[model samples]
Target: MENRDTETYPLLTPLNHRQQNQTTTVVFNAESNDISPITGAGEFAREFLVESKKLWYLAGPAMFTSIAQYSLGAVTQVFAGHVGTLQLAAVTVENSVIAGFCLGITVGMGSALETLCGQAFGAGKLDMLGIYMQRSWLILNATALILSLLYIFADPLMKLIGQTKAISEAAGVFALWMIPQLFAYAMNYPIQKFLQSQSKIMAMAWIAGVALVGHTVFSWLLMLHLGWGLAGAAVVLNCSWWFIVVAQVVYVLSGSCGEAWTGFSFKAFQDLWGFVRLSLASAVMMCLEVWYFMALILFAGYLENAEVSVDALSICTNILGWTIMVSFGINAAVSVRVSNELGASHPRAAKFSLVVAVITSFAIGILLSLVLIIFRHQYPMLFSNDPEVRKVVIELTPMLALCIVINNIQPVLSGVAIGAGWQAAVAYVNVACYYLFGIPLGLFFGYALDFGVLGIWSGMLAGTVLQTLVLFIMVYRTDWNNEASLADERIKKWGGA
Candidate 1:
């Protein structure tokens, strides 16, 4: 359907320009013959559902890319499991400590790439999109070098985490080798964002799937057959990621990126400081969100019955992480779609896209909750078998399920904020909700109330719920028409729009 068609559908409630200045308010129609605000949410929700379906239509391929990216870890873990519990434990611990903390943040930095490309594509400045991609590559490459240094220091870091000498030794070896992939991880995200911003996500998905398969083959040959052990696994993982990056670059060079990719341009390096500042801000915000859980898991160790509780929480957190990655894919697509439409000066379309992304994410959240509810008893068996661990997993399943629903809205809204270029405000919201309130509450509940893993999770959920509410309010009060103009201004400043 056309965006003009969306304007024909009235908003939940009309807003006066005066009301728009406030952060939060409910506008009323005194002269209306027979309309209400509650009716507005329903009407807007209906329009939103339609728009969301359209966004998902575009998002499906992107989601495939996201799921593949996340599934690599799970596949790696499963393959390692065939080797032994120790190998499985080694891979899981290393990935959580290194990959989760490091790689996840790197990929997130790519969100800036997605935002730039999306807005440029919307403004019909296809050439600038290509330039932005190069800038992102430069930024990520530098960041990767720094992260590699950090990875080298992981052995001592793990030891500090109180892991045994043996676990730290094994984890350290894995982390050391994983450092090189910082280059791969860094390059891959910008490329992925580049493709997504152009709305050519299907190409990336196919490439990622092929890379994952190659990773599996290499893992089997190197780890199982050659007895190369953890080092072999690390090498396979790194190579596989590079393979994906190369494949994506090949597609771009072959002109699969459409006109938005105007070949590599060095001019992207001109605004180095500006790009780095924005990219760094974007990276820090995403890293905070990703590490929030890891911090809780570490904190869990400080609580009563430390070892089992931490392990159990780790398993649950891993499961949640995998699911969140899938949503992150959709969320990336949402940012691209919304930003593109807004940049094109199609406020109604951008508004419609926002509505759609939220509803689709919300529905998926509900379905995810149901899946968790159904699997509450059985899901943990896939990872470990200690009766005690299984019981803990079952106990925390409900909170995990609820978290899924909240995340559906939260991350997508964050994406919307990215598309709208409202990162500063959203970052502040994250600090207040996650750090100020959530972490402190989690400590009190987990240690003081003796609520175990669930208590820690509850604290996290409290943060998410609060964050989601604030994000929705932010999105709701967004002056989409004005942001569309600002997007144009941003492009004009770059000599594009």
Candidate 2:
């Protein structure tokens, strides 16, 4: 593991006057004699199996961590459901519409770390990870401040957006109480990517596990036993997330990542605008995808029997979110592997890794989809016992099952884009597919055709299908050689090696 690669550490360009004008780029061709490129069917199968192990090693824990963290919100929603139907609807709107917006922006913004830290770590420029992470922290904290303003005026904003007055007032209270969580997200996300890039991820999974357990107990005690209701749920969530942040900080400071973390540096404050540009690309890309579903919830708020409709849709979305964690986990793993391999200039390896990750995740998604289909009626009871909510959920279960399979494919391709540093391109595709076409079509179906909530969700699914197809084609046509070369150029330009 001691990478003594000259191309990865030393300034690879020649310093001699005679060769000063000539570049000294070292190409890590997969065809090099030292390592054979996977060619034959048997060899490719063996390579696929080997890479699957690596991919899953990263994905299994990553998925668990994602679920644990996301479950905090779901737990609060569940508790709210048990309390009363109104409380459940209130929490769903606030979480899906309000917090979901923040989630898209912050989580997406922090993903810039996946690109920077992943590539830097792959290049053996380990010292740069901390600086990249800190720079992300600064940019995202500023963004979070701007988003907090929305939370402050959430009620008016919702009413302006055409939500019911009663729903707006209740959701506003939940949103305001959830403000502290924004700052936690700002710090926690970059930390997650930074640790993940270096293959130091179990700490994240463990911390999340603890936080989820705490969220459940605290939500019950404070929200139910103490009868603090939504406020208690929000406060407990805030504390739980911060606990992960504090734990991760301690892990780094404890010298677990001797290669990556070196305390804090002023370098983090330098070249911020460069980081901002990439962060914004990721932010826009994520916001577009995440808000697509939240839009569904928003449109549902306008339907007849709005409360019942919103409640069912929210529960279904939670189910999707839970299972989607597996794909998200694969997304993270493939991002790291591709970025790392590309950074190391191994084109064939990176391509092979992507293939393995995609197939493996797709298989898992299919299995999960089957489970949802089989248990459609039984599963809704976990969130709410109301007969009407359950009935609406029954109607949507088929869509969720189908969407789960699509969800697995889309995120994996997005992961490939992230690893390849194509956030800006992906962002453009997202806007065109999800917004320019998807939303308008969804509106026509929902209102014009009077298909209601199911119509809106179906339209959103179409957008996802289009987005996934485009990304698949893009990935299929990618020249792995060019990607490796570009990764080298980007690392050098960033002064990594």
Candidate 3:
């Protein structure tokens, strides 16, 4: 009875109210409340079912859009592969470093805009969303500019990553030619987040799909008939990004975006510094997760008998990357949903949003694992004719299957942390689990124990398991009320209601 009483009322409530009166109040409150207090915060909990369903309805199309964007580069790489083995290898090297690394960094930095804009939109401060969108453009572009200069020195970085002279020269040629797309991302990602936060993800998704189809056609034409090789393929991909950007910009100016897009302004430059600091932390958390594999892949190159191993691993990684985009799509929805609910002072809805996201992600993971198992033998043959690479890939099939499961839980929770403004804590956890524990363990397993690629992969599995457990605990223990308070602060900071 005491435990029940404690659960029903906070410590101060018991001291102030008579037993009968407290009981009456509790009954009255339960009847009047509309939301699920256990799952969501304030009024959002009252409408948890409705809000969560709305987000789900929106997520399906958005996720598909995300899939299309992710596969565009893959399609380009495939086209390049047809040109020659050198072209195929060059496309892979350039993308993993330039398109994948630098572009991923820009995309990750867009999370801050998602958080801020979601909060503003939820609080009936729709105009502020536009302001934030403009401000984010100023902030993210500056970072893009700095990184572009770094891309100019692509050869040295490729060399540092253990690329052979031939691969380095080929990768450098493609990478330097790809710098403009970096700016395109700086523009596209911020706009993408701004629209998403306003529940307009579908627009960006549709446009991106159209752009992707066009991109593929162009890439094939340039690489094949035009005979431009890897550089031509890179140029086609860059044009596709611009197409997406222009389409989105046109939408923003067309009154279709309403107050979700404020006109471009110099004031955005004023807020640039603070926005960059916040965005940088979010970017680091995302970068740490993405680059972990790239590190492992590069390390494989250093192994004495690494050629077949690297190719097989690349095939597996590409498949995993393609599927992971779905999780990322869901994650974006989760961040937007949770942030919106919290900003509106609805804790219960925030909780419900997270629950739905995690459950959906897990289900997808299980399904993907099954798919990986079913196609284990057939999938490798799609990429190459090398019997040696196929053999290595067959051996790692089960590990990739397991990786799908661990990844589903981890990335979605990272989304929750982003929504709650817990980037700093999450970043610390990633560093500890991925760097401090994972990398060291994998290196030791691969070299010291002589387990080869499998050993390195097992270390990654251990790290992911540790990281997932920590995220689960962190999310479970979150105080919905405190999260509500943080939302209030974000609203004030962003000039929202």
Q: Please give the range of 10 consecutive residues that has the lowest summed lDDT in model 3.
A: 7-16
Q: What RMSD does model 3 have?
A: 7.4
Candidate 3 local lDDT, 311-364, one digit each (tens) = 667777777777788888788888887776666555765787788788788999
lDDT values, one for every candidate:
0.71, 0.84, 0.74
lDDT tens digits by residue: candidate 1, 156-269: 887797765665676777788887677888788888777777667778878878877787788878888998878788888877777888888888899866666777676887
What lDDT, from 0 to 1, does candidate 1 have? 0.71
Query: Taking the tens digit of each residue's C-alpha lDDT, what string does model 2 give over 65-99?
Result: 98999999999999999888888988999889888
- Rank all candidate structures by their lDDT, best first, as comma-separated numbers: 2, 3, 1
Top candidate, metric TM-score: 2
The 10 consecutive residues of candidate 2 with the worst lDDT sum are 9-18
Q: For model 1, where is the 10-residue window of minimal lDDT?
A: 26-35
lDDT of 3 at 22: 39
